[model samples]
Target: MDLNPKLPTLPAFYQQRIEALLARGSRRLLGLVGAPGAGKSTLAQVLASQWPGQIQVVPMDGFHLANVELDRLGRRQRKGAPDTFDAFGFVALLKRLRTQAVDDVVYAPSYERSLEEGIAGAIAIEANTPLLVVEGNYLLLNDSPWNQVQALLDETWFVDVPQDLRVGRLTQRHQQFGRSAQDAADWVQHTDEPNARRIEAAKAKADVMFRWDS
Candidate 1:
């Protein structure tokens, strides 16, 4: 994750202190959500960096439909859309993680950008994990399985930045990952922007919405 982002420090950002988030006798799931380039992952990782053992991040991007599946459905170009994800699978995984056994170790998937695919069991959530920071694009989405995500999370944060900044970062990200400048710009305009607007519309559903420090 990039190092520029900061942890959400406002008192209202939490129902209690950060330490309280890591319950001693219970497990807590916190959702950090936003559009593609809105810094939700960065924020979650930063928070984890602040408290090592007590926090772990499990990204929802791990549910991306395989390239083969995307092509079969003609959704390769619309990869980040909600329907392109295994929403039911993700919800099932969260349900298992929420009620994880005392000695059971649960594994979750993570998206590998270099390969542009979801890698299975890339993240291990131990039974002792106190808080899980689940970051994703559609955690607050009102759709069926996606809506189930909010009910499972104890708290949720929506991160954002100005469109120009977000667009610039997204373009650079695409370029860094091998897309040409023109291709990156076109993707941001055609794909990312539409998703961003949809996510922004759900801002009201988050527990808190804060600008990602630029």
Candidate 2:
């Protein structure tokens, strides 16, 4: 229960900076972009937990194309790749989140890892929620609609860790989701690593880049 000693607690300055954003009296979108196994989700959850009602995570994974659609497009082997997501729809959601927060609940899709699909209206972002912690692998990508995401965010952080650690975590995650050990490793090497390279290349576009070390 004592995460104080074990977890990678966020630095005080980062907390202060987020507080300053909340003080601005306007809704803010904060983005967390990183490689597949780099702990972006973990870091975002930690931050959002600290702020409680003031911050909620709106993940880009929710924009993942369905397994059936990926199969239809012949992209099932590369499910986590940027092209396999609904980039335009994700961008539209981010734009809507900017204004819809005060008028009523702004519902966001959520990725169901067990079912391996995005469930619509899974996250209900409450009215006047002060900040949204958006986490994903491609927010800072310079390609088309994903590129448009950076300008929409009030601030962004690119989470990172050594490649070996990332690969290990990704393999373990895949295995947990019913992948055979060899299949998990193969997926990481052939699929996730290629995407990691592209995501890592865009780190310079983030407001800050740091090790998440989950």
Candidate 3:
């Protein structure tokens, strides 16, 4: 169960993992799961950038219910909770993309933080692309909706960073998005932390664990 202690960064490990998966010849679906601010999306972008157009990146935030829908369901306040996302929609997309031919392109949704909503068709995974990297905070969660997500991925990686660093990053991210410092700290400690705790226990589900340098 021990891993290489000298591993420099999560991205370095990811490169090797991707190489091995592609060698196996089956279409690849790589899921990177972590708490908010644990750098899942950043790692996804690293993979996409390194592979250029060949690797497609799909974000879990893309499946979040619209603000209007959240309000309608009276769940807008708990926006990042398990029930806040359109789990069925996300599952359907994953199912379709699994068997899609190389000639077909699948348009995946993306979430815009500034807009606080999802933008449909903002991402495209072409049929010719052989690898799909999906990143999000709840991909490995055990609850309904999220439980099935792991089944669709060829491999799942759990990203781990120092708790202090993760909390700091989340606070800054919230402030950058218009929250006051007090509000940011409060949310990270309360809402984000609780969710992070839930996700921390799911790390065992990952095929690999990428622990970021402290």
Clashing pairs for model 1 are none
TM-score, structure 1 vs. true: 0.92
For residues 24-54, could you state the per-residue lDDT of candidate 3 as single tens digits?
7767899999998888877777677777866
Better of 2 and 3 by TM-score: 2
**Residue-wise C-alpha lDDT for candidate 2, range 68-164, written one tens digit per residue:** 9999999999999999999999999999988784568888999998999999999998867888999999998888988899999999988878787
Task: Give the runs in model 1 whose Cα sits over 4 Å from its true position.
Answer: 1-17
How does each model score on TM-score?
0.92, 0.94, 0.91
Against the reference, the lDDT scores of all candidates come to: 0.85, 0.86, 0.83
lDDT of 1 by residue, 1-214 (tens): 3424555554444535456767556998988888888887877777787778888999999999999999999999988999999999999998998999999999899999999999998999998988899999999998887888999988888887877777787888998899999999999889888988888889899886767557
How much lDDT does candidate 2 score?
0.86
Which candidate has the top score in TM-score? 2
Indicate the worst ten consecutive residues by lDDT in candidate 1. Answer: 1-10
RMSD of 1: 2.3
Comparing 1 with 3 on lDDT, the higher-scoring candidate is 1
Worst 10 residues of 2 by lDDT: 1-10
Q: Which stretches of candidate 2 lie over 4 Å from their true place?
A: 1-8
